[model samples]
Structure formats: C-alpha cells, structure tokens
Target chain A: MSLKSNVIGALILAGCASLYGCAGQHSEAALQQAGADFQKVKEDSNVLRIAPKDVIRAGESLARADRLSTYWGSGSDVVHYAYLSQRYSEIAREHTTQALNEERAAKLELERQRLQLALRESKLLSVQQQGKWLEEQIVALATTQTDRGLVMTLGDVLFDTGEAELKNSANRVVLKIVQFLQLNPKRVVRIEGYTDSTGGKQENLKLSRDRAQAVADVLMDLGIEDKRIQVEGYGDEYPVDANASERGRAQNRRVEIVFSDEKGQLGAAR
Target chain B: MAVLALAGCASDPAPNEQFRLTEQALEQAKAVGATADEVPEMKLAEGKFNRAKGNMADQSFKNARMRAEQAELDARLAEAKVLTQKSEEQVNVLNTRIVRLRKQLGDAQ
Candidate 1:
C-alpha cells in the first residue's frame, strides 16, 4: 500500500476508536444509578451491621458494572452486573431483617420465661402468707393442736344449767372461730357436747344433743356453710375429770370443737 | 419465481415461540410479587424482553433468541428473589407475635 493509503487507514482507525469511546460514555447514566442503589444499601445501619458481607458483595458488583460500562462499553454485561448488584443489595436487606427478627424473638422468649417464673414465685408467696395468717388466727383463739385436728373447749359456764342456749360471753370466741373457718373454706369442724353424771342417761344425751345443735346453728348463721360442720352429743362419755367434786363435775360438762383435715373430712369420732 | 419467493420467506424466521415463553416467564414472576420486591431484576427482565420483541419485529432472529434467553434468566432470578422476600416477611411476623405474647404475659404477671 502507498503511504497516503496507510495514513488514511490510520485516521479511520482513530475515528472508530473515538466512536467506541462515545458509545462507552452512553452507559454513564446506568452506572450512576447502580452506584446510587449500592450507596443507599451501604448507608443502612441494619444492613451494614447484620449483613456486611452481602453489602460488600453488592458494592463489588456495582463497581464491576461501572467498570464494564465506562471502559468496555459492554451494554449487556453492564446491565447484567447492575441487576446482580441490586439483587445483592436486596439479599442484604433480607438477611438483616432475618437477623433482627431472630434477635427479637429470642428476647421475647427470655421475657416470657422470666414472667412465668415471677408469677409462680408470687403465687407461692401468697399461699405461704395465707397459711401464716391462718396459724396466727388459730393461736389467738387459744385452741390446742391435736392429732385429730385443732380443738377448742368451752366450759359448762358457757350455757345455763340444763339449757342448750349459749351465753353472751361465749359469742366472741365463736365469732373468732367462724372467722377462721371463713378464711379456710376448705376446712370442716365437728362439735361435741358433754354432760355431768347427775342427770338421767337419756336426759343427759338429749341435753347434750341440744347444745351441740345450738352451736352449729350459731356457726351457720355466721356464714359457715352447714355441710362444713358435724355435731355429736357424747352424754357424759369421755369425761376429763372425776364427778365427785363440783369443780370436777363442771369440767366434765363441756362443749368441744374440732377442726377437720385439709380435705375438709372430719377425723375419727372420739 | 415461486421458489425464490418461498426462500425469501424462509430467510426471515420469526421468534414467536421464544417470545411467548419469555412473556409467560415474566408473568409468572410478577404473579409471585417480583414486581414489588425485586424491582431491579424485574425491570431488567422486562427491558430485555421488549428488546427481544423489537429484534423479532426487525426479523433479526439471532439477536432475538439471545435477548429472549437473557430475559428468561432475569425473570427466573426475580422469582427467586420474591420467594426469599416472602420467607423473610413471615419470619418478621412470627417475631412480632412472639414479642406481643411475651408482653402480655409480663403484664398479667
């Protein structure tokens, strides 16, 4: 070829290279958009903290897209890389969301367990307080704890001779016992009445029965349910003292109240 | 003369089947929420699909086939992204429920 033709060919080659450079410049807008998307993802604190690796991958993909668009003018390749960059950013967001949700669930589970434990502890404390209160009330009534149950004895003076009506002075002790029964609704009681040896056996038995029934009536009127009380008249049986002296005979004539077991079942008959 | 005319028709092979397949894939992706969460991938797929249709209109069978194939891949990627996003949302909802239950229990206590 001649020098002129060679020079002309060189000029044509340069012109083609410049035209390719112009085509490369056309991808600038797409590159800018990809860069903006990647920057937005990187700026998200959650993505940065929880999905740093994914964010880095997105940044790398965006850089590759920018390079392909600016240097090679590879339109198809640039678009593919940009799409990949966007997908990576979305993946980073998904991972960050998952991490945050898992953390929250774990915290909630811990809180639930703590609340359950606290509730159980509080219930136990309440039960213990109730038990202590019941014990204090029983002690205040001057009752005796026995194998059968708690027992309180009312002397013969609580009633007029041969009459079943309770005296006014006995009302305070009966009211206290009723209060205790109300507090422990699950407990039942058995009331027993006794008489001295002076009366006929049948009459003594009838009198004892009347007195026991009267005490039960008073308890029922005070709000204790009828089903929770059992009455028995011993009729001079199981006397606590000899009947020879007046004081001993008085001791023999008494009314006794016995509390029941936890299941509300009264113990064996005396 | 008739043979020559037939030959001319054969030279311009239409990419009807490939175009239809790409369109179906795009529709499937959109039905699965690709349009909302996977916007970038869905847009890329749509752009490639439209370009493929343009190539088909110009009777450029080779270019049309290449673009249709790329579009299908992009659509499939978008569908996968939608699936991932749905699972992530479910996890978030479950976490919120657990938190609410815990709060209720605490308040009751």
Candidate 2:
C-alpha cells in the first residue's frame, strides 16, 4: 500500500480502536451506574430499615434533650435531633428494650431467638450510628462561623438570675451537655462563660470563670477527657451588642464554643 | 425503501458518530489553601448517578441498587478530594484533560 493510504487506514483503525475502548469503558460504567441505581431502589423501596427499637431510642434522645431545655429554661436541640436522629435512635431503643425484656422473661422460642438477636444487634449498631450523626452535627457547628455556633446562653438559661453555680434544674441541662461532649469530642471545648455588663469587671470575670468551670467540671465528671476542655471567662468581652437593654445583655451573657482555629493548623500543612 | 434509508444515512453525524463539545467548569474554592472542591466532577458524577436512577428505577432491584451505589461512589469520591488535595492543580488537570480528550476525538472523526 502507498504510504499515505497506509497511514490513513492505520488512523481509521486506531480511531475505531479508541472508540471501542471508550465503548468498553462506557459499558462497565453503565453497569456500575445501573447497579447503584438498583441499590437505591432496594433501599428506598425496601423496608427502609425502620425498627421499633430505633424509633424509641430516638424518642428518648429527644425527650432527654427536651427535659434539659425545660430545666435549663432555654433552648433545646431536641427538635433538631428529633428530625435528624430519631428514626435510628427509636430503632435502637426498641430492639435493645425488647431484647432485654425477652431475656428477663426467659421466653425466647428458638424460632424467635434468631430474630431477636438480629434486632438487638441492629439496635446496637443504630445507636452507634445515631451517635456518629450527632458528632457530625457538632463538627459542622464547630467549623461554622462564630455568629452561628448553635450555642445556648449560659447565663439566665443555665443558671438562676445572677448565680454562677448551676441551678437545680440546670443540672439536667449540664448532664445533657456532658453526654454531648462525651459522644462527640474532638478538640478543646472552650467554655468561655460571659456575664452581663451589669457587674464590675472583677465580679463578672469571677462569675464567668465560675460558671465556665462548673460546666467544665460536669463534663469532666462525665469522664470527658479533661484536657479536651479549656475554660475561660470572657466577662462581657465581645458582647453580641451594646448592653443598652435587657435583651442585648441577655444575648451577651453566654458561653461560647470556639473551635481550634483552622487557619493555623491548615496553614501548617504546607 | 432502500432509497429512503440511503437518504436517512446521509445525516452528518450518523448521530452516534458526532459528539458534542463537552466542557465542564471547575471553580476550586479553598477552605484554607486546600483544594477541597473537586466539586464539579463530583456533581457530574452525581448527575450521572441520578440519570442512571431515572433511567432504571423500574428495571430491577440490582439496577436500582447499582445506581444508588454510584451516587454514593460519586459523593465519596468528591469527599475524598477534600483532604490531601492541593487547591487548584487537581481541578485544572481534570478540566484540561476532559477538553483535550474531546478535541482529539473530534479531530479523529
């Protein structure tokens, strides 16, 4: 064959070969895609992993959070986790409770025994999973900007008027917080307690420091790694706004959660 | 009938033979000098999975599962880029490579 003609033919062959290679890639890709789609359907169309136990666990988590909010006289993340974590938590509780009940009753028929075991195992997994989701939310909050820390005001809400020590009702709130800290710990949790500008700097700082310490101590008591928590007294510093009014000061009297600055850590990566 | 088929055959692309100019834009936003946003490719992968799901939602269990799996794959792949990636280079490479491949394919045709 002439050189030019031979080159043209070879190019055609090469083109077809590449196209065929692409076709192969496409084929496998298409199958993988199809399989993934099928899996989604199976997941969505299937029972969707609903468990009575999980629902119960989620309810308990929500109820506990609510009890905490009422006792603290402030915000509760109950509504939030209710929507997000309830399904799994409920499933966890139902299975765990049922398994315990059966064990107590000593009435496990052999046929039902395997199913009970499976439910209990799944319950444990679901609780573990729900805890993971709670961690993710905290991590997301920690990384979010300061104005949006999903933090509760530590002053009026957590303690009685002008009190640095936790209120009787505040104990539940502190315990809930301790649970959160224990489940989702990563870095130093700065409990920078603040107070209204109603007091002098010395008294305010002491109150702030005491309140922060009170909360920190609870977390420590709950077996949180003490080193992971840092307590500070911001003492009306960086007020949310001018302390010209009740609402303004109420907003200011809060404990802050400051994530370790990502700038320094990430910058050090280079 | 044969003549009509011949006329239909004269269409420029044979439809299958002609490929569109496919280009994707990658806006690599850094959180802190990290090229975390392998986001465009991730979106496209997600779209592919979505399309797969749409096309095969009623086909069979295996097919639907596969599509969902691809969605997770794409999601995970995008997430994987968040760590260990330099801010701009990886995205630039992907954007340029896809375009270059398209051009070469056209030239061949």
Winning model by DockQ: 1
Q: How well docked is model 1, in DockQ terms?
A: 0.13
Model 2 CA deviation exceeding 4 Å by range = A1-124, A132-152, A185-187, A259-270, B1-109
Residue A9 displacement in candidate 1 (angstroms)? 30
Candidate 1 lDDT over residue span A1-270, tens digit each: 223432443343335437775224334444555566677778799889988987887777766665555433355556656666766776677667667766766666676666667666766776668767865877656456778677788888999999999999889889878877876779898999999999899999999889988899999999999999899999988888999999999998999898886678788887
Output the number of the TM-score-best candidate. 1
Q: Global lDDT of each model?
A: 0.74, 0.47
RMSD each, Å: 12.2, 32.6
Per-residue lDDT over B1-109 for candidate 1, one digit per residue giving the tens place of the 0 to 100 score: 3453345446756777878888888998888878834478788889988898888887767567668866865786677567666666666666676666667556655
Off by over 4 Å in 1: A1-30, A39-64, A67-80, A138-147, A152-257, A260-267, B1-109
Candidate number achieving the greatest lDDT relative to the actual structure: 1
DockQ of each: 0.13, 0.01
TM of each candidate vs. truth? 0.43, 0.34
Q: Which 10-residue window of candidate 1 chain A scores lowest in summed lDDT?
A: A1-10
